[model samples]
Target chain A: MLRFIISLWASKLCLFLFKHTGRERDDRPGILALRLCPNFLDRVKKPPLVVAVTGTNGKTTISNLVSNILNLEGKKVAYNTWGANYKAGQARCLLDAVSIFNRPTKDAAVVEVDELLSYKTLPWIQPNYVIVTNICRDSIRRNAHQDLIFSRINQGVSKLPNATLILNADDPNSSFLGENNNKRFFAIADQHADVFETNVSDFPVCPKCGTVPVFNYRHYRAIGNFYCPNCGLKSKTGDFIGTKLDFDKREMLVKEKDGEFKYPLVSDTIFNAFNIMAIITLFRTIGYSPEVIAEHIKHIKLPENRVACEDLGKIKMYTFSAKGQNVSAASTVFEYLAKEPSKKELILLLDEHYGDDPNIETITWLYETDFEYLNNENIKKIIVAGQRYLDYKLRLRLAGIPVEKTVCVFDEQTIPDYVSTDGIESIYVLHDVTTVLRAKKIKDKIKEKITNQ
Target chain B: MKIEVLYPELSNLYGDYYNAKYLAMCIPDSQTVFTSNNDKPAFLSEKVDIICMGSMSERNQEFAIKHLMPYKDKIKELVDNGTFFLATGNSFEIFGDHIEDDGKKIECLGAIDFYSKRQMNDRRNCFFLGDFQTEKGEDIKIVGHKSQFSFSHGKATEKPFISVEGGFGINLDSKNEGVHYKNFFGTYILGPFIMLNPQFLKYLLRSMNLNDSLLYEEEINNAYADRLKRLQREGTEFLMGAE
Candidate 1:
């Protein structure tokens, strides 16, 4: 008890001091707390209603949407606004939720938990609702494979047998979590399901027969309607189904167990469509009315760090984040950029950054990404900048991209000098999360060059 | 040149299939034949210049071993006769004596003198920088990454594919990495092993009696030089977790 009080009060003091001192990156409080008391999470006071949103991707957007809806409904809610999804970040989130006296002040808390770290976070959070967005291939250093991550989540969910699991029926890899527990599913009948193609596929085999299940409708790698020919293992239908998605119209019709209702599409990307579906399913399962949820969702926009667009007269530049070492995320961004009808030039800044972590960066994930999408004739010149620019160039060459079409620069700031604004309608600056601020500066430099041109 | 990929549908884990794709790009007029688990491998029936296989899940590894058990002698003959075979990640384990996971042993094709022990609780993730000596006695620096649940044991130092300068090889404490018996080369290091090492790819092409001119030779060499400098830098971490 004394340890709990000391850890909590000490962390609370750290948060206070950090906030006053303008230490915007305040994960130190949680780290300090954990250092002082290893099991501080188990002893910390939590809100009566806690929801943990977790998956390989889309956890942040889903958790944010859920928390936004709850806040709009006049419930005092606490969530991790900064991108801290791990155990230390989660500890900091909980500390911020409670009063200085260590009593919970919020009515509810929506926590975004990392998939690999879920086994550690879920047991302590003891959430009433566990919303899983989807499971896909992530970094090999962090997430070895989907099987390992699935097992980790399974270990976490096993502790909370009564917690309702909100799953993505579209993802076969994640849909089967907590098989015996109560599960509510959300699915989207992808309009562009058949057109998906990629080199890296984390396809799931049938659990019973050990056969690779054939997909009836494959939206992208390992996602869609699948059925095993050997064991008759089939994909599950969702309790909440999103249909008639019109990307241009920015509208979708959602059918729930209660009734069918029209909701405004939050984003045009297929993954964002799934994110909205997961958010809707969670809100509806937790007794939020459809009308109220839709109203709040209409105001929520995709975080600029994920994707942002700027129109510099006739030349449009888009800053798209292709997460480092994440194959699916990079592939999605590449495919999306390739589908755009405008003549494009690509400025790739997708190098893994060496932060405080001691591990050497792995470059194997580059082969899995769909760099072939950039081989289209519409793409004029590809400018790659960073220490690993040659690695990307080699992968692109193997993808059948012409040698003359690619330009390599060791210095990222010099990328603008090689970018060709002539005969191209727009330039796409594809960047890694670590290089977002650098991407913005590159975009600004390109904007200046265009204005001077 | 013909490159036959064995059980690509099953062994296509961790993006190691790109090694085969890259080899094809380096070799002119090369045709790739992808043989699924249900289909018989083309190498078993025909003359192929190279046979490639990537990684797979442990469960699928069992299925792969079961499917290939009948051709153990054939695999041995091909390896002895200098048929170039490249197996990346744990696919190389399928050619070993056995794989011991959690006290249970799954017998593999005993073509090699090694066995693999798997620990479900511990996964080894690290960067591998090694010295690879080519057939012409030219020494080349080979760099790649290893992320796996199991590591091979027993007599791996007999003819290792590469000498480990950094990171763990085969197991936690082995400086000798992988197997290099005759023309068969198997290793856990795969940064799409071929794509990352252009000089090694050239050596591979030269050994296969093809024109060793690599596509984008200058850019690839520059990239390799940069990577080598970074890997050799003091305090650059080669291991992630406990050694």
Candidate 2:
């Protein structure tokens, strides 16, 4: 009750500021709503086709895709475009959905939920459709272990039987939710894709039965075919299965209701397929078509900057995905280099917040990936410069890495990704969870370095 | 190959057998023996390749001395001949000469230059940095967590055991993967080894000559790889303190 009252006051305080100064932001309306009612979401209007997408990866992308699909069909979508996924964030989103007189509206509210808070928000807004993006060991520093993560996700999904649950079939644990079949849909990737993750294996085995699960195919970040020999349960055909059109070409072939139907997608890679699949399937159930989805792609870009292009003298260069806890990005890096060898130096950064945490030990699993194991001898030197510089030095060192091919540059300023003055085509990796403004800052720096030089 | 993992209630302290499960995954055998000191097993001497000890079950003054009695002499002999053992949490110290938990002094097996105490959960949840050696004679750095009051002999140890830093490696569950003699190595690395690190599993499989164990190595490893590449990249930033 006290929390409710405090929340109420906070909300009013936010509203007063916005009303007086006309400086509206994401949090103010939510503060006002909390002031109106602590259980605002529970009492607020919920659309019939509401879908909540949550997980460690792919939440933002997935949320956008779903909203785009709905908008293509010319339906209203009340959402948080800022990726404000907390309870207050949702309240703020609801506030935006309301008119000046304040009435709940929208054909569907495609919501991205923070993984930790999904359970807390679920009861308040028991979504009619819930999509689990994928499950990897995320935030053990802030959350608990992997098993606990799985358990918590299970808890969240278990609460919504009346809702349609769409899961990532490629993810063993996440796909397992499909077996329950409380009207759930699953998305999977096909094996024929030229793209493949070089690294992804090395998650802890199931404590229930020690027998390691089998694998049919893997699509980076531990999202692929799997089942325990002892358990005798392998992931089967999910209601919504995804087969990548090409590993290199980033196109996804969507198969719904087993293999009875298939369709092509513009989004590339199984990871993106997951995001696209969630939106297409749920909006289709809510009533949208491929052509409707195709309409949105005309304006959308595949979460650019992950493989964004930048000018470096006469050479065509791009900053590849790195720095995040993304195996797919690393594997893609391997795929890029292997498909088209880069003799030029690749500049990678390891910031303290992203990779410096010694709690960041699982990074060693990179050794198992085809990248390090296959290309032990590759192009130019690997610049290892980060806060926990020695940790990267040791991780690379232990990979039986050729010391001559690697250079440890500890100070951030010393890292090559900082500048393109030398006309070097470089790949600067970035982690996923970051202030977008910081990414924009880095992007600006990259732009200035290349253009100014 | 069957691996025996004992949840030494007293010596199996802090349920260090989770670390044993980790080591067992690195071994070739499917059979594992897990017997806690609170419930000592009778068939402990029958060709058991690995024994995992947990730390103190309860926080008390005379924790180590009371818990490590059953396998005291046997653990020492196993270490001398190189039998693999995992002593995590407070279990690492029960094998030590003495452990001062709060105000009590308890004697232990004196295996490594280590001792422990019973603090709150401050030692309970913290990540550590270490290394594991493969048969190919390469050192593999490992990062796992521990929550106990034990400390290691040195800041670092042998191959397969890298020196760890910038973590919660204080007087608590010293991130030690114990000494490796012959086939015997010990440490506080908890949880499923084969599942967490495929290198350790690969080492165990190759050592045990079980190529069959690697049937799904590519796929399983690919899954981990996908996650790890990001982890390593992020780890670089994390260890770099970029965040």
Candidate 3:
């Protein structure tokens, strides 16, 4: 209780200092507050429609998709597209939209929950809808494998009275959670040929029976139509249909038992579409229309970090994906890589600064992706840079990349050493949220050189 | 070489099935089979020229050993003959005398020259770098990651894997190329390891003289070469000197 009083006093102090800190990029008060009260998520008032999103990848993309879909249904939504999902950060979000008096702002709160924290605090919020994009191998350093995280997510979502569970049908781990007697909704990529790779950490055999699964086809990472050869329960998602994947237009066409409609793909990945499918299903369950969803997608773009392509000599993209337990970010990474014939050489930088605890445990979803599938004739190399260079290197190595093929640059200044002034005319960069600005500086220098040319 | 793959419940960090497929692809039409978490049988079959193992939790290790007791003498015989087995993450540790968890000691097959201790801070990593050789005696390197915890500490007198902060590695991928063994290779490289590095498969085939019996498609061969070059040229990850 005394700690709460101190935290209350600190919260008031933070609110007061919110106006005083000018141009200070450091999250001092935030860090202090977060450290002081680890379970700060309990502080926020439970909103009407508290939706918790999680996975090894695609958490944020789905959050944006769901939030926008809700907005289209004429409900106000407040969320973080930048993957700001920690408790205090989420608190700041609630404080940002609502009045200083802690009143509700939008009709619903679509919160992007971190994979690790999803298990920790979802029960506190008692979310109306809990969407787990899919569980692949992520963050084994800190947590267990997919099944454990899946159980934790279910535990949190189940705590909410009549809370709906939305999952990916194609994912072996994610789909398994639906077996429970809960109000579960499942969505999947229409075709086995996926747009984005699933983030996989470990090879999963049937827990019930130890048998290697036969994958009819691999979508990404560990997600696909898999049936355990021994148990014969590998995968049963044959008729499980989803929206047709249209990468060019970035629109989702979903058909239900009653009717069929198109939901715009906020980004160009089937994995994101998978989450959007969950969003639409939840919205429809809570009484929403496809027309409103279309309207909402027109202006909804919280995943704004997704940038347009620029041709240097080769087409390189400068995008931001997730680090730590942010599977949504991983999904974004796979989406960009899976788009073409893996022609665009990727430079993925995972910065621990995105979250306070950048434990590699949450980032273990690196294995769930198909680095080889993306390794077409066009793909040159995957450069890992930033504070946590070794972490990314380790993830890529475990993904079956030969050590000789990967490059790591711990020093920020050395990044330019690899930049060809004019050969491959493109650079696809995925940066963490906190490191996005620093990444931009590097990009800006390159852009200026190209512009001058 | 007919490789025998072991999907131990402990070594399966990053889709150990990929590693199984990878090794099978490298061998002569090798048949990849699955073993349950607790299905360790002795004198099972002589057909397995090479063995590949997967990952498992600590309890699963106990489960495997609990069943493997009857097969201990056979397993020990195979190990002594260097019949060739590949185990990664916690699976290899189980082959040792024992694996310590939560201050409680769990009995292992006691094949290797050491014991494995599982700890949180000791993370081997998901990706790694490796240097090995091709069939034509060409120097090659591998990149992939997994956890390989538990050191031999002069037990088997095996060298280290390039070296990293937390022991050898607890994750699936190695920090260096190739899981070096006298034909008995074990690595933490995910995607089942072999599928990720098709070059390793190509090299293994030629090394085993299966190239004459196997149809090596130019498309697949060129694709592998191109990928290596592309990763080396444009990719941010590379072997030590290449970096």
Candidate 4:
């Protein structure tokens, strides 16, 4: 008990110092607390309503939406707004919610937990609601495979019998987490979008009958309405189903057990739509009216740096961050870029940034990614840059992209020189998540090139 | 030439399927057969020039072993006939004796006298650098990555695949990386090893009695040189797992 008190007080002092020193977001206090008290999360007092949002892709956006909506409703919500979703960051967020005496002061807490580390962090936090967005192939070196991630998350969620789970019914891997636990599933009604053909998917065989399930309506990468002919397993629109997506009007209709309610779609991307749906399902389960949630959601927008766009006089430049090692994320971005009607030139800054460093980056994700999408006639010049330019050139060649259309520049600085604006109305700059700052600088260079021309 | 890719839907982990793809590109007009878990493998009925299989999830590994169990005799016969077989990542475990996973013994095809033990929670991520002697009697450096949860153990080490120079082999203590008997090559290294190692790819092509000409030879060679120099740098950590 004395050790726990000492650890709490010391961690509180560190948090206080961090705030005073303008380093409040740093997770050092949490690391120190965990080192001092191995079970600090279990010992510390938690907020009344603790919610955990976990998945491979949209956990950050969903948690942010949930936190912002609650804050708009005049409820104090604590969440990790930064990229630190690990245990140390989660512990730090929880520590910030309580008093120095270890008493809760916030109305609620929305924590974004890493899927791989959720098994270790979730049991301690003991959230009231756990929302699994979706599971897909992540970094092979870290996550290994989706089954390992599913196993870890399922183990963690199973321990919380009292906590209700809000799941994405379209994802076969994460939909069936805990059988006996309370599960509320949400799925989007198919928009009849073209089913993306690729070499990547992780929707495993039916657990009961050991046969592949049949998808009545397939979305991108194994996300859709699926059923088994051999067994009784099928996807259900359990509590909430998102339908009638309108990217032009930025609106979507969500149907619940009571009635259908219209909600404002925060972003035009399908993944962002799912993120909004997950947030809506969460707040509605917590007794928030749809009108109130929709009104607050209208003001909530994605970060500017995530999908920044600039008007470069004649051509529009869309600079966005795509996850490097994640195959599904890159494939989704490629599919989106390919569907755009305007003639575009792609400046790919998507290589792993640490090639020059001591640690080597894996190129396996390249083969898994659908670089073939860049082969569209609308996409004119593909200026491949960075240390892995040769690798990208080889992959693009194998994807049947004409050699004349592809330009490989060994130096990243020379990429803008290789990019041609002729016969192109837009330039899409796809970068790795770690290379966002570098991408912004390259975007500026390209902007200069176009304006000066 | 016909190349049979076994269980591509399941064995397509870590992008190692590109090995077969790269080989097909190297050898033009080669018919590539992608056999899924639901369909019977093409190698069962036809005499494929090369049969390849990559890694997969543990659950799918069970399905693979089950699908190939009835043809264990055929596999043995093929091995004795000196048919070229390339099994990368954990797919190598499917042809082993059995897998000891968390005190449970999952039976494999038992074509070889080796057993793999799985570490469910621990993943061994490492950079592998080894030597592969070509059919021309020249030694070529093979560079690849290993992101696996299990390693095989047995007398197959006597017929070691690539003599380890830097990274670990069957296990931490063993210097032998994989099993090389006849024309069968099984390694835990993931990724497109053939794409990364041009000389090794050329050697592989030549051994299969095909022209050794490669696509993007200069670019791939440059990449191999750059990666080799980096992996051999002083203070470069090879083992990427916690003790």
Candidate 5:
């Protein structure tokens, strides 16, 4: 116990030093604590209720939403808001809530865990509920493929005999995790939206019979209500179902066995709707009333770091944090842009910045992404900037975008100057996670230029 | 010409389907048939000018081996007959003798002498720059990325598709990268290998007796040259083994 306290204090001191030294507050402290005391996570007293949100995407947003809602309901919560989601970061979040005596002061903790790190994290945290938003193909170098991530998560969840899993029934890869475990599912009903198929799909064949699964309707990119024709295997009937998503009104209806509830749509995108639905199901399971969830959720806006819009006089500027090396996330942003009924100019800053490394290999994730969405007629001009700008230009041209409309800049700093702000109602800046600060700087320059004009 | 992409739905794990797409772009009139795992490969019935297969999950690799095992003789016959076969990433491992995952060993098609062994926790990733001798007696530079959990072992009877100039080859110790049996070209390199290496693609085109150049030849070649130069400077610094 004495050794554990000493390690905890040392971690706190490290964090204090990091803050004072103007360094980013990350998982380094938690890692240091673990190094000092290998069983630091086990030594600390866990919160009364620990909910872990994990998956390939939406983990950060879901974790944030759950934490925000719980806080609104007057419950103290600890979460990793900086998007540090590995085991060390999770340990840091837990340590943040505890006193020096090692007793947790918070009532609950909403932790965002990386899919692969679940095996290292879940055993120590012993979360009461593990919400897997959805699992899909992520970065080829990091994730490999969806199946490998699924297996890792499965191995982790198998060790959690006391936890119930919250899964996405629409995602076959993630829903498969619910097998042989106490699990509840959340699914979005057929929205009747146009399903534009991509060249690749993560789950085209049925896991059980190795046959092509028959889909009643596809939401997007192999996520849908699917059943195997050979073995009669189908998507599990979700306990919580989101239906009648009215994007114009920004609202969706959630139906449970007992009754139906309406919640303000978090974002226009279906992915965000799924995140909202998952959080609702979690809050409902935790004994929060439907009215409380609906009311509080409206106040919880989407994170500005990811998706934010600002009006600079007549021109509306939008910024989306498209994760570098993630095709699905980038595709989602493009899809959202395509649906907007306005003439727009796009600024693509999708390069994974490897600071001062000129020899860094060009990422292949660009080819996997569907740049065809940017070929929409409404997009008047595209300004692609950064290290991988040439690669982006080539991909965009292959996707059938006209060379005249596309402009390439080698450096991100010149993006604002390159963007043509003429005869366009809105300007969209799509930046990667690592280059968000640069995106903001570019946006400011554009805003300044537009204001002067 | 007819190009058959075997089990594309299962095998297109990386952006490797772009290889087939680029091939189609380069040869506008050619029809590319994407064969699903459930259906029999089109190469079984009709004449296929080229057959391509890409990366896939380890579990799906097992399924692929099982699905292709029955047609092993046909594949061997096709290879001997000098039909062009391009297998990228882990897809090439399916044609090998066997794959050992953890403690379980699954038998492959045995089209090659080597065997693959996968370590669940150890995934090796690297940027490769190499040269291969074409049938025209010209050596061309090949640049591609490799991210895999498994590595192949054992001596290959035939010449390798690409010689290791920078990164680790077939295994950590071997300089031979992949197998080239007649017209069958197999490599662990991913990233739409043909698209990244235009010179290699041109060699492939020459082998097919096509006079056509690559689509966006200038840009593709420029990218290839730039990548090759960077790889030369880095000198295996970007090459990372299992963690």
Candidate 6:
């Protein structure tokens, strides 16, 4: 008890100092608290309902949505909304939820956790509900492959005996986790996107059989309605089905057990619909009424700085925070940009990491990314920035983009100077998680350049 | 000419399929056969100019070994006849003696003398900078990435493919990496080996009797040069630690 008090005091002091120093108190308080009390998490009084959101993508958005929806339902919720998903950040979130005496203040907690840190976080928190967004190929150096991540997540989930797993039915890799556990699935109905062969899909062969799985309709990459003809393996019908996507109206229809409900769309992308479905499924499973969820969904706002747009007089500039070392994420963003019916120039700041001494070396993920999307005729110029600009330029050229359309700038700071503002209607600044600040600065520079012109 | 990609569905991790894709780009008229794991490899029934396979997950590695075990003699014959073969990343482990994972051992094709052991916890990932010497005594710099959960052990009966100029080789102990049996080339390096190493790809094209001229030669060479320079300047600090 004394140790817990001392650790709590130390954590409070560290957080106070961090705020005074004007630093973002994301992980340091938790790190200090954990260091002071090695078993700090074990001693904390968890909220009545503890839910954890984890996966390769959509974790942050889904976690934030859960917190927002719960708050709208007049419930006190504690969550990691600052984009800190690791163990240290989770510790800080839990700390924030409690009083100085370490008693729970919130009715529930919606924590976002890093997939790799599941073993470290799950056993201690022992969440009542675990939501797994679809798992896919991620950073080559850190993640290696999807199987490695799947194993780690599975190992962590196995530690919790009573937790219900919320999975994506579209993904066979994640949906397979529900075989012998208390689980519910969420899926988007087939949009009938053209099914073509892609080398980037993580699951090609069926898990049950060695034969290639036939896709009824592939949404994008590997996520879709698929079944193995040889083994008769197929995706189970989702408990919550998202359909009738009206991107212009920014709304989608969710079909649950109690008739259909109209849910406000977070974004037009199919991934966002899946994220919404996951959140709705969780709340519904927890015995929340569909009427209440629909009422709360209207007020839900997506976390900012992921996708932003600014108008610079005649030039409209957009910035997308594409996850680094993730080929699928970047390819999705590029595909979104390709669909725009306007003359555009693109700035790619896709380096995995950044700093004065950034050790960004692995460029293999670039090959997996569909750079061919940028080969559209409307995209007049592509300015490749950061340390691996040469590699990006090579990939673009190899992807059939004309060499004349590509420009490489080794330093990211000089990006605005190279971006041609002439005749282009929009300039898209694509950045990774680590380089968000740099992207903002680049965006500012472009806006200034356009204003000056 | 037919370029056969063995089990592309399972073995295309780490974007290593681009090695074959880039090769086909260099030789536009070449026919590319993408064989699935359930089906027999095209190299068994038909004449194949180049055979390629890339990285896969650990479980898929075991399945690949089983799928190819039936055609061990055919693989041996292909290697003996000097058929051009390039196996990158974990796919190279399939040709080794055996792969041990969590105290269980799965026998590989045993085409090479060495055996591989998977370190599930310790995955070694690094930037590889090496020199591959051609028959004409010319040095071609090989620059790529290596992200693997396992490394090979034991002595190579013949010579290793490339001498490591930077990063860990075949295993942590040896500076020699991969196996260079006849025309069969296997390496742990991913990065779509051919895309990053234009000079090495030129040599490979020459060996295949295709036109030695590479597509996007200038851009590819520039990328390789920039990578090599960065690796030399950064040295070991840039190498990722195996966790």
TM-score of each: 0.95, 0.64, 0.68, 0.96, 0.96, 0.95
Per-residue lDDT tens digits for candidate 6, residues B1-243, read 899999888888878889998898889789999988878899888999889999888888777888999999888788788998999988988887898988999988887678888888888877888888888999888878887878888766236689888887988888887888888899999858888888888888888777899877887888888778777774455368643
What CAPRI grade goes to candidate 4?
Answer: medium
**lDDT for residue B214 in candidate 2, whole number 0-100:** 51
Candidate 2 DockQ vs. native: 0.07
Per-residue alpha-carbon lDDT of candidate 3 for residues A351-435, written as tens digits (9 for 90 to 100): 5532222222222344444454444445566676654554455445545566655676666655655654334545776666556
Q: What is candidate 1's lDDT per residue for A106-220, written digit by digit as tens?
A: 9998888989878878999899999988788887788877777888899999999889999999898899899778999988875765455777657646755667688788766
> Per-residue lDDT for A424 in model 4?
83
For candidate 3, what is the interface RMSD? 10.2
Per prediction, fnat is: 0.53, 0.03, 0.07, 0.46, 0.44, 0.61
- Name the runs in model 4 displaced over 4 angstroms: A207-210, A451-453
Taking all chains together, the TM-score of candidate 2 against the true structure is: 0.64
lDDT of 4 by residue, A71-172 (tens): 888988777787578878888999889998888989999988889988988898899999998998878877888888898898899899999999999887
Q: Is the docking of candidate 6 incorrect, acceptable, medium or high quality?
A: medium
Tens-digit lDDT track of model 1 for B167-214? 888777788788888778899986488877888888888888899997
Determine the iRMS, in angstroms, of model 2: 12.3
Which segments of model 5 are wrong by more than 4 Å? A16-24, A354-356, B234-236, B241-243
Using DockQ as the measure, name the better of candidate 2 and candidate 3. Answer: 3
Per-residue lDDT of model 5, residues A344-371, tens digit only: 9998877775335565644677777778
Q: What DockQ would you assign to candidate 4?
A: 0.53
Overall lDDT per candidate, in order of appearance: 0.83, 0.53, 0.56, 0.84, 0.83, 0.83
Q: In candidate 2, how many Å is residue A244 off?
A: 6.2
Error of 4 at B30 (Å): 1.5
Error of 3 at B105 (Å): 10
How high a TM-score does candidate 4 get? 0.96
Per-residue error (Å), model 3, residue A96: 5.1
Winner by DockQ: 6
